[model samples]
Target: MNTKTPAGTEQITVSNITIDIVRKDIKNIHLAVYPPMGRVRIAAPFLVKDDAIRLFAISKLSWIRRQQRQFAGQERLPPREYKERESHYYQGKRYLLHIVEAEGWPKVILKNKTWIELYVRPGTTLEKRHALMTRWYRTQLKKQIPALIEKWEQIMDVQVNGWQVRQMKTRWGSCNPDQKKIRLNLELVKKPASCLEYIIVHEMVHLLERHHNEVFLAYMDRFLPHWRQLKAELNKLPVRHEEWGY
Candidate 1:
């Protein structure tokens, strides 16, 4: 926790504890406890009073402790830079990157059924290389989305009106039951195919159960028993480096 008092809100600190009060574009105060350690965070609307926020945190102390414990057991991957011999996951398979330089635009191709074709200059900066690779990933996801939607529609008996992929900063996927649409993070293409399938199934189940209550978990377990493992692995993997919103 890092306490910072912005212009609108006030900050408070207690020993190792730090709290930041800032304005946000939301209706409620959201408190979070992140992993690898029991770091606490609170986000309150600009108009929320300091006393009210303090009371909320005090009331949720037990819940926050439980969240910290969950995070403590979860694994976190180190930061990555697009470098030679770097490992990447695709559809539950790990592939070593083989960078090759060419005269034309960069292109990726599978090589020897063991490695990946990442056509880029050796001198290319990690950021640019990552961008190009991410773009290709989005393309691959686009090619697969339609078939996946159809495959799942029959298996889960749920119809999707539309689906789209984007560079989401935080969550892997989101579902809108009213519109029968699901938006998936393009980064999911980098993970195992089973992970994507789990997400698809998870979102589709939301069509029947709107919230993550007992019914939702039961439906998920009935449809995808190994979903919990996939979710745990997904959380351990490195995510895109971008600002996230709750």
Candidate 2:
């Protein structure tokens, strides 16, 4: 079996398009088009040369451009200071943030799904307020995962050992077939519910097929025929505001 080790990171330019190449002890090179922006990443076996990786990226230039164009049209969330009256998204819907100060720990409540009431102690630091918001987001995302996992497990006839919600910079979700584990981006909670469901199903499908190869595509098509539409819709929404290393 191939050994597991920390992956190496490198930057390469192919036809004026930059690609981040991650070197891992794997059998084949896997290319991923990430969202918020279509940053391309290639996970390749350690023996592969930078030149070979460049050539591979060059070969997929058209597909890369298409994915980038898609991201270019999507809306982008601006840097948030967690102030009152600011816009926030949950499950694909928009809500105005309403902050109320009290002498206790912070809390978040949805006001009729149209507004988010953030209760924070007076004189709370900006970082603390942001943390409260992030914690709320994590809780919301976590609540949605179980039902989706159970539903997909039945449909896909596969069971994941566990799944987690986390702050992810690159992909929305990933699955490790060996460990039967799945991880989803916590930022996904800000998007539409359909988008979140799409990601959950997408990762679950990975249990059946590891690579985003034709077989994987076929499985996605067979199980979630509307996956392409859902993916497009998800990509069309505003990506979370983060300082991404591209």
Candidate 3:
């Protein structure tokens, strides 16, 4: 798409090599580096100058490359099929999945020898398997979130109004300080329970500090020392597939 710039019409490149700039209803320029490969995105204001954008990108090239390398080196597990010998993660421990077809409702069982039993209907599609796993995940998280919130509230001395869970596409969690509420992504339940606690603590800290600045880092370090490691693990995990909108 050709964008109208003050200096006539200057073309901007968007490809695998460099960044893609998009304009949206956002307060500030937000940069993101995606996984599986180093894909950079820059969301700038529509009225921002092209030269200024290029200069900002060039100045941050080193930091951007470092972020890309960090994302590139992150470990990612292969997608799982709810079949025998398949692996599933719970509380940071890996277990082989054992598929069992029972007469009634489906359930997950942790058998001995590092195994998980997935009881589902016959001929279940990948989406169905994911749905079943997600449901189980929410169940697991619901058991843990309350305790974590109670713990963090004591430590941070912050009381949240409420919290909820869902399959979020782009965000790990979000907070509305005005409402004193937090929203955590349901996918986190598939990860280690520590990961869910980390997200909860992180978002809860947002009630104290809004942005990911020094204050936020200090809060995380004080509240959860291993937050960076947990964040890395969380990002490396497979994200839900998204349907793009115009």
Candidate 4:
């Protein structure tokens, strides 16, 4: 039986690798390696013993090191300043930002397939500009998401009660299996459409199998045969600069 204890966080070292451990009222141990630094964390059931967790960590030492190395070598974009001529991505294409000062209503548009025209009032502050761009990204992502959800629902025979877009720092997407709801990271708008579909399918698959265990992987493989390739492509894309917190 799973313990209903409140979550607690602590750390342990195995073979010189520090692993963050969080004990929660969960059924199975969930291990994850987060990006931008490949920080390793394990969310285990409260009843699981520390010795077991340490053994698990020791077994995954090589995988942890590989993930850390991948993160260390991945390309990262510099901080966005929302200024003219700055490079930005949309649908896997790079375009220069073209700032246009206008009288009313800030809007974003694409011009000649080479520029992202961001129209704002004169002397707009950096924060406002960033917010405007984020809203635009959100709008664009929302437009594309429903169609993908509809497509996957029929194919996977799953019902998504609801979906939302959020600016997440650590995860690409997450799902509430019991609620049949999924939340996608707003940053996905900047990636290729295939990547977006991949994330949607991944989250939707969680509705069939809650944990990332063997059954979950089998479902993923059956539903999306080329999922591994898409996952690699998504991970290789340049991520935006942000102050990440554990």
Candidate 5:
């Protein structure tokens, strides 16, 4: 029996692990464990039976627990107050923030590779400061992405239509294979360039294979042999602190 809610989502409990199921027009079942907390979700075809979904979840139980444990052990940075002397990250290096009050427009600059100088007018609120820093991160990430995309396009034989950087709570990046466009998390600016390149390659591979099946893994292995290491490195880094919403 399937217990479904009004929102068209169902929950199945197997081995005390609850899995959220959403029926979609997709061809195959897609299981995912989301971050911040290990929320297990499955996107199954609308015609699939409840028992089959339950059995599939059962088979992947060990993988699900491993992912949950990883999220539990993952480091999370404390909430940012956007104040002076606060530690910030750029290109995987820690830098202390130096707030400068001035009459001119707000701007961000790196000084001596040890400090992130934030220039803002007096009485700037925390929200404004955060917005300014986010903009700067977006700008810096955008500047580096196109070149990486171009580099991978030739190696992988795929052309990306467009890409954008946005703040995402649960995902580092996503791809729309149909549109040939990808959206990367703005928080990636805090990680190393290699991690950024890994994500770009990962998304581009989606253009070749829409699913995370054997074909996709084969493409990843062929294009970036050390991608798994880069992925592990990215996952081990400190994630930004944010209030999660369902």
Candidate 6:
């Protein structure tokens, strides 16, 4: 499809990687690798030339390629059938799902760290079963948020107005520092608890600095010294399967 270009944005391929360059009136060049498919982007000063941008990308060629490779190799959980013997995750631990049909309320319980027993009434529909499991995950994840937020708010000396969990396609967490609110991705309920806390701390730091610039990272370093490691671990976890819309 043909589309009109934004006033100063252009697309070019460099070092076998497609780079989207947006020219802005800025003091410095910024390069980023975004997720889902690891799209590379460069924000450059309005006067910068394509050749200079190519050279910059070339300098970071190895790093860019490595990031792309990691994205390409990221694993995904097959669509859930909500059937017996399927694998599921909680707190980064894998468990086989065991569906148990019974007479009472629907629930999910981890039995002996090896299996997740999902108790439901007979003849539940697929969507209802999925909702039951999703609700259980949300309940478990919510239980930990209050303590984590409280701990960080005191340590960071920041007040959070509110927080919630929801399905997000591309972000694990986001902060609205203006409103002092945080939103954590529900998918995070499947990752390690440490990873969850790491995201919380990262978002809370936005209260101090909004941009992911040097100041923001410095704050992260001060509060969570091992934040880089935690980020790596979180990224290493399998990403959720998303329905791509082109």
Query: Evaluated with lDDT, which candidate comes out highest?
Result: 5
For candidate 6, the 10 contiguous residues with the lowest summed lDDT are: 1-10
Candidate 5 Cα errors over 4 Å, as ranges: 21-32, 42-63, 243-246
User: What tens digits encode model 5's per-residue C-alpha lDDT throughout 108-148?
Assistant: 99887899999999999999999999899989999999999
- Please, what is the TM-score per model? 0.66, 0.78, 0.72, 0.83, 0.83, 0.87
Model 5 lDDT at residue 108:
97
lDDT of each structure?
Answer: 0.72, 0.82, 0.74, 0.86, 0.87, 0.84
- Give the top-scoring candidate (TM-score): 6
Per-model tally of clashing residue pairs: 3, 2, 0, 0, 0, 0
TM-score, candidate number 2? 0.78
**Per-residue alpha-carbon lDDT of candidate 3 for residues 1-246, written as tens digits (9 for 90 to 100):** 335457554335443245667765444566666664666667777687777777777777777788778766665665666677877777667788888876678787767758878888787777887778777878887888898899999999999999999767667789998898999887677777778888899899989987655567789999899987987676776543342110
Residue 72 accuracy (lDDT) in model 3: 65
Clashing pairs in 6: none
In model 2, state the lDDT of residue 167: 89
Candidate 3 regions off by >4 Å? 1-32, 41-53, 69-80, 121-129, 237-246
Candidate 6 local lDDT, 127-202, one digit each (tens):
9999999999999999999999999999999999999998787788999999999999998899899999999999
Q: How big is the positional error of residue 124 in model 4, measured in Å on the Cα after superposition?
A: 1.4
RMSD of 5: 3.2
Sorted on lDDT, best first, the list reads 5, 4, 6, 2, 3, 1
Model 1 CA deviation exceeding 4 Å by range? 1-80, 121-127, 238-246
User: Which tens-of-lDDT digit does each residue in 156-220 have in candidate 1?
Assistant: 78899988897786667899999999999887897777778888888889888876556787899
Candidates, ranked, TM-score:
6, 4, 5, 2, 3, 1
Off by over 4 Å in 6: 1-11, 20-30, 34-36, 43-51, 243-246
